[model samples]
Target: MVQEIDKLTDNVNDIKSLFRTLNETLESIEKRLSRLEKMDSIEHRVEVNQIDLSDIKESLQRIEETHSNEIQHINRRLDSHLVKIAKIEEEMIIIKSR
Candidate 1:
């Protein structure tokens, strides 16, 4: 009977050790799951930022095109004014010669 009691005690100790190992494994798995959730959140934010950057780029392109068109219009006006000034100078020269 004493030997049987020693065998039961040994079995209890083995079961306790197994339980400790199982608990440790579960804790490790939970930590991994938490890290994955955080990573997914960061990835979602990155995607949103990329979309915002794309919109900003399009707006800048539109502004650049508008500025280019305005510059072209100003150049045309300047050319017209230069032509008129030359014609006036030519007329003055002709009158002075007379």
Candidate 2:
């Protein structure tokens, strides 16, 4: 009976040790889960920022295209006005010579 008691005591100690190892594994898993949650939050923010950046780039391109067209129109008008001024100067010279 004494030997049987000793065997039971040894089994209890083994079970306790197993429980301790299980607890440690659970704690490590909890830490890893927390880190993954934080990483997911950061990744979500990066995705949102990427969308915003694309929107800004599209808006800037539209603004540049509009301004480029306006500049071309203004240049055409200026060229026509310069030609008219030259014609008037030539007419004035002809009148003076007469």
After superposing all C-alphas onto the true structure, candidate 2 shows an RMSD in angstroms of 2.7
Query: What's the distance in Å from true for residue 41, model 1?
Result: 2.7
lDDT of 2 by residue, 1-98 (tens): 99999999999999999999999999999999999999999999999999999999999999999999999999999999999999999999999999
Per lDDT, the best of the predicted structures is 2
Q: Which lDDT value does model 1 have at 82?
A: 100
* Number of the top TM-score candidate: 2
TM match of model 2 to true structure: 0.73
lDDT of 1 by residue, 16-97 (tens): 9999999999999999999999999999999999999999999999999999999999999999999999999999999999
The regions of model 1 sitting more than 4 angstroms off are 1-22
TM-scores, all models, native as reference: 0.70, 0.73
| Cα misplacement distance, residue 15 of candidate 2 (Å) | 6.4
Query: Per the 3 Å backbone cut-off, how many clashing residue pairs does candidate 2 have?
Result: 0
